[model samples]
Target: MVLKNLIRIRRSAARAEAEHPALAAAGLLPGLEALPNAILVLARERLAIAFANPAAEAMLGMSLRQLCQLGWTDLFPNADAPAGAIAALREEASGTTQLDAVLELPQREPLRVHAIIGSLDAAPGYVLLELVENEQKLRTDREERILDLSAVNKQLIRNLAHEIKNPLGGIRGAAQLLELELGANGGLREYTQVIIKESDRLQTLVDRLLEPHRHPHIARDLNIHEVCERVRAVMLAEFPRGLTIHRDFDVSVPDLRGDMEQLIQAVLNIARNAAQALRQPIAEGTACIEFRTRVARRVTIAKRPCKLALDLRIIDNGPGIPEEIRDRIFFPLVSGREDGSGLGLTLAQNFVQQHEGMIECESRPGHTEFRILLPLQC
Candidate 1:
């Protein structure tokens, strides 16, 4: 089906070239270069790419020169449905055709897209193919949910913290007063000391729960790899022997504007959590964590369109998150480990959201990944 469609496109291109030689040679329409969807034009003879817009280059992770070198088969290796739709358009009077298709770009995950194929009136010899990623809607919806959940968590934490704080202060003061009443060496002084100590511990917990609200966001231009390195150093220092930390950074990614300390703390919290989960692997000397950074183009975040974004991933080789708590990992007080404070991931999510970013996780036995997406241009 794809081959027959390619033949039809080639024949149409040949006819257009015969009718308007000059326009066919120009390859692309004037305004198509500025489009957000990945657009490509096929040549009159062999269905080779004659023109590719900037968005196409970004989507395919190639230069215009590189794309021109590929044939239709190279671009759509496992394509389906769209080819038949295009063939139908050629046979019928339809000016355009649309279908869902999978696009396999170089060294990237397979992209699901809604492909729109049509002919240009001015350059009829050329076939115009536009690809709009299907994940945009899903990403936007997920981001909205994250924002809503974060808002609810913030309100609940503030109210609960305040309620806990008032009683905690009173309890600590009353214990102090009682301790003084019974002399330092009195029989019950130790009991009063225990009460004061426990109160102080609870106060600390409350303070942590309210920390995100108390702190002001301070934005600065900083390199993401620097944050990764800082966290990597800390994790290595703490682990020292068995765990291995690796880096796969794209140095060309531009510096992002965000709160440096908050971002650092956010990444550190996740790394520390991963390290803690690697106890069994560490003992066997097979534990590994990798920090990878890349530039994502044409992404949607929090229902907003962004031309460019940062994709940072922290991947670990360890036992996966338990299925029972996996869905609630970011909820405060939820933990898979017995000794875990359960606030690390919650604080991490809050910090990332403050920078207009979102974090997503995927896990299975022996492989777990946390992806952080932050928009560079919206």
Candidate 2:
């Protein structure tokens, strides 16, 4: 009877010590109770939730008590396990066992976890599970795929444009020669002249298509606002009479490294598009185009993080881009207006990308904004 009483006292003391906060502080209880990741603990005979972080609560959509009542096999069916054969092998192993597996929850999706089975200091038959989601890994894979596709598309455009350009120049030159020989009352000279003009126009389009590839970058330190101001002045001069152009500059934005001519051309393209959009509004005395600048930090472009970047927004309060072509507006030869060559936004995008930046457009019924995000020192 004395031996039995001593055994009971020792067991009670062990349980008390296991439940004490000192154990938690000492990191003996998995140290995951305060973490934000989903976790669970189980014993051999019956499963009890030893700890769960906030992330676990949010992920499994369950409370502490609710999860404790459920068994590992019940929460995750054996047939649906990620490492089916490995889990069975671990379960049948001799001493301490481990299984890297994924569990699919009823409310939530599949969760990747490393299940570790071993003896706690006092609890001999307990197991600890460290669950971590694979969502970020999957996201990274998707981003890599997108970048590969973008590169392939750009290469195809460059190759096709080069092939079409040489033949196009020959066609235009031949038409011009024919027109010169047919001069003086042949009247057929007019048709040759038309051919020459159309060919020249097509050749111009091809040149625009190849501009970004052919022009070598000439980068230097220059004030970004200076570039913006130059573009503004050009647009004002081109549409002097009725258009109202406003500058909302952030004076503190520092200088950027870029090719002056290319940056000017890129900004001019976007601003010119805005000016055209505002033509009817200008006639009605309600036309307004705003050039705004701001600083953005930790921006992600093309799946890469840029620490410090500059944002230039060209906003216009005119009839927005037509809804049908809005999605494909960045594609070469796709345009919203009848007379638009459809290469302005494309060229802008190409130049920005050359500077390791990105351009995006948002448009609604009455508002349209084209935002250019570029690295500050690149």
Candidate 3:
């Protein structure tokens, strides 16, 4: 709809040009500056940029000043001849002429975009460039896959918990009997103690695994900041010395109906996971975590679209998530850490799902961000 309206505006500007030619030269498409899709108007004669839209600045991951300093070759230095791509763009002006290449950055990931160069109908030596990130579509598809796998994981976790529960009691009882029979024999009783201790630990883990299924959700009206504060206070208490939990919140956000405890657990689990990763850095006095919130509009979660939703981001600066297990991090038994049970994120995912929300993680060296989307009212 935005794209269509922008196109209509451009046509109107063109038609009004005969009466007001100055408007056509100076303000052909002033509104494109706010467009979501990245757009750049390049002066074909000088091979320099005339304008970079706000979306273009973000999509390119550079400031407007930085982008204006770059030419077609400077942006795509490795490409075979982006100039030819631009030359062909004007000839085949029916639609966007798609270019089959990626925009490489200095050290970051190569941004994938469908590049199309269009020519200005009124001007001969000016071309328009459009770039749309492919990651957005991939994310939408990933959400569906996550929901399907989450359903399967939920049943599997329940069945595994029940299976583990029965034998766990028998093992603990047998170990206790063995320990009692071994009475004063210190060496042998210690071994039995180990067995009993391990059994008890497993039992505790099994109980935790069944926790979400065991409790009935207690829903209530609450501000999300309350939840953030609750989590922030706990994190500060645990790692008070060097860790900083910054709050960047939208105070105008309205309260959403949710299970306060569940939401708190959900946020806590994610925040705690980040804290654990930041442990080494915290000791060196450089660890930081951000709890940022914003109002997300026209959002979709769990295959349901909400007019309003909360976009909560937990950003941390630490050695990024291990790439090997990143894709399956939310699975019940998957863990990036060797000693981790890997159920924190799984349970967090479950709690958010209970509120008809979704969580996604993006990680790279030195930067990791977890975005949670919960409906304002579901």
Candidate 4:
């Protein structure tokens, strides 16, 4: 009974120690590395990255070894002083401070992080910096907005398509009747033929607007390379003359579980969009498009933290997406080209969303890239 009591006391003590915050402050806790926020230890004088957690490494797109080789400025591509911030905190006696800052990395766009800079009570001149990316905080907001927009857009699309679908057949039949009444020799038949043909075109447009939402997502094991190859073949066949499609696929990326046909359509839509943008350049024999696939490490996609995701970029050297509709590119019925039905990207976004993925676009004059990120673990 005495031994049992002793064991029970030890277990209680263990739990107390585990709950202690001092271990984290002193850098003695292994659990610190497992947190979602990035942590870095910087020397007070040099403001250099002396130690980094796995999250920090992933956040900065640099290994700890690589980060330790350079000062904070050099490590975070386009960030200002990190250790200097910590040094300023040292003067406060508490040796801790919180600030919001933006950092630009080498491999990705800029990141806004909430930084907690502090020093261990036992370790002088050794600062512990805790960083939580705003991405995680903003993810839910972005996802909710996207979902709400998708729902509203879907309802609007269904209503509009159904509205157009009903009148389309009647319009075509009336045009046909008018054509028959006018007879073959009448010039007015040309006007009726135009009405029938345009009615068919409008019907086709309505069908495409409703297509992605209607189809049930048939999930299957999809080899990404096969999808890329299929898209490449289709694009090359269509724009065989002056366009070049380059492939930089990382074979290490594992197969993803998704609807093969839907995934194919999603990718093909983006690829074809890029190809179409290169219309003038393709004739100039200067058009180039690249299909680059790589693994995205430690990414949060669609509000879900994914240890790995597929990063597929369709890059084109054509004139960029026009600025007017760039923000509303994913919205239904928004189009840059006059002849464009504007449903291609909307359908593509819907298909990707069905697979728990997203399509992001970045464009400027002479360069346009549509990046698709899909979680591989799903």
Candidate 5:
């Protein structure tokens, strides 16, 4: 819709150009600048950038003067589709064309965008290009799927836990009665004790699994940095000699309403996991974990849009998560380590979800980052 309106304005500018060419051109610029979508005008000769709006400047991470120094191919290096689209527009004199293309950036991931190209009637042999980022929509869709799956998984866990709790108690009680019947000095007492001890262990495991659902959320205004400090202290104490924890906080971020203890636990679980994964690095005296925070604007969580959000990242310089379990790290009973109980991330996710936040992770060979986004009222 925005593209259509901008195109219509260009046609109107062209129609009124005869007696008021300068005025028409002057009025068209403010309309483009006022728009939030990134727009760039390409010269027909070398396809060099003839104009760029403020949105384009921000999105492309370059000023109009800088953008003017580059051509379409420079901006989208080796992109065949966008090059073909420009070629067709010039040869056939097409009014408009649209395509999904990747825009390459310096030292950053390639941005996938929906590109709209139209002839600039106001300036012969020039075309206006509008770019709309597709990542936001894709992220929102992925969040929705995660939320849906989480709901189903949580319900299944609750039902399974309850079902296990009842029979589990009966089994434990039966073992106790058998133990009593056999008495302390009896031959079968050792086997009864084994049954009793194993049942108790399973009972403890079940309790941990059900703990998050049972705990009442206590909300209060809390500083996110304070929680990070607490987790850092705990992790450093555990891995004192080898590990170094760093803090990069946006102190300007305001306090948010949340369950402080739950937040601490969530952060600690992730940090502890990172510390454990950094075993080799720790032994080599090179282990590091960083707690970074920043303010994110115009963010979305669980399909709901927010004006502001707290972006908290826990990054570790260690061997990355094992690829096989990376995708299921947050799922219950899933763990990368052999002895891991596999409930830390699940509980962390649950705690964050209780405060209307979401957790996401990205990992490669030597870098792993866990990002938590919590919507802020401000």
Candidate 6:
């Protein structure tokens, strides 16, 4: 009976550390100093609260003194063989590590988190464990909703464009015929000419709307860096003086299969927008644009993981996106600049969606990052 009791005590201590590793590490159990968040640190040997964030107090429902007074065994009554788990984790070499587990709080339900464990260089004989809630499930749900809406939006745009095309041609033809009937200098003929011009303009818009669908998929193995380089050259030539363009790429990333021309256009559209945004900075000769790429794994695009994804970030150092129009920046016909057509991003998004990808934007004063997430296949 005594052996069983000792075993239970050890198990309880282990459970305590697992629940509040931060407190155990900081040794905050004895004096509950108010901290910002509910974070607890645990030490390797004793499994006692070393430090606790204010958030931890709310989460555990215990005062610092109360926590310090209780032994690990007293806190966790039903923990089984907890000491063994700690021993196993400690045996591994010191480095950043992660584990997914359930943590029970006082009078509260068990919560799940991906616990990150690593040795702290600043503190000797101690480890740091940070809890990050597993948000993959929620991300998956959001991706699904966005993708479903994008697919539906694409189909509607395509159908609408097709329906408008035939009528548009007829209208242009009728106007042309009317113009020919009232040869030169006829006031009424000018109206027909105007009709033809407006029809042509609408036709251009419709063509752009249908372009992504009409273009045949031309997937070929190509280097993304090459694409970015080509875009950089073109933009530099177009905007020659006063703007500095920087390239930051992950050279290790292998070639991906995609339409080279479409990718170029998509990138160009974004780059052009950045260049335009830098008008003020360019005048002062301090405007800059950066093209950066990295590898992202298990990224969900359109509700499914393509397994591997490329993170292409277009950064600009200029006045950030205006707060009034930031949220609607991706919507069609929304433009922050007075002279902007607002169709650039719309077209870019359409092209990217065709390539089975997604785009996200983040902006703050003097900084903006547009991230394009594209899938790569082996």
List ranges where model 5 is wrong by over 4 Å.
Answer: 1-36, 39-58, 63-103, 108-110, 115-130, 180-194
Best by TM-score: 5
lDDT of 3 by residue, 1-378 (tens): 989956754544344344435435766556667578988777665556656676776677776566667786777666554567785665653344676456676677777677777777655557878888776566778999999999998898899999998988998899899888888999998888888889888888888788789999888999999999999999999997989889999998889989999999999999999999988999999999999999999877888888999999999999999989999999987888888898999999999998889999999988899999999854
Backbone clashes (count) for model 5: 0
lDDT of 5 at 368: 100
**For candidate 4, lDDT tens digit of each residue in 1-378?**
978944643443343235443443554435555566888866666766666666777777876557767877665654555545765766654567777777876677788888888876655656778988876566557666776788799889899899989889999999998888887666788889899999998988898988986878899888888999999999999988999999999999889999999988999999898888889999998999998999998887777888899999989999999998987888988888887878889999999998888887879989899888999863
Worst 10 residues of 3 by lDDT: 14-23
True-structure Cα RMSD, model 5: 6.4
How high a TM-score does candidate 6 get? 0.65
TM-score of 1: 0.68
Candidate 2 TM-score over all chains jointly: 0.61
Candidate 4 regions off by >4 Å?
1-132, 136-140, 214-216
- Ordered by lDDT, highest first, the candidates read 5, 1, 3, 4, 6, 2
Question: lDDT at 207 for candidate 5?
Answer: 88
lDDT for residue 177 in candidate 2, whole number 0-100: 84
- Candidates 1 and 2, the one with greater lDDT: 1
Residue-level lDDT tens digits of model 1 in 1-378: 978944644554454445546655665444666577888876434657877766787788886667777886677777757655554555433388787777776678878888888866656555678988887665566678778888998999999999999988999999998888888577799899899999988888888888887889999899999999999999999999899999999999999999999999999988999999999999989999999999999887776788999999999998999999887899999999999889999999999988988898888899899999999998
Clashing pairs in 1: none
Query: Candidate 5: lDDT of 224?
Result: 99
Better of 4 and 5 by lDDT: 5
Q: How far is each candidate from the true structure, as Cα RMSD in Å?
A: 9.0, 11.7, 6.7, 8.6, 6.4, 13.3
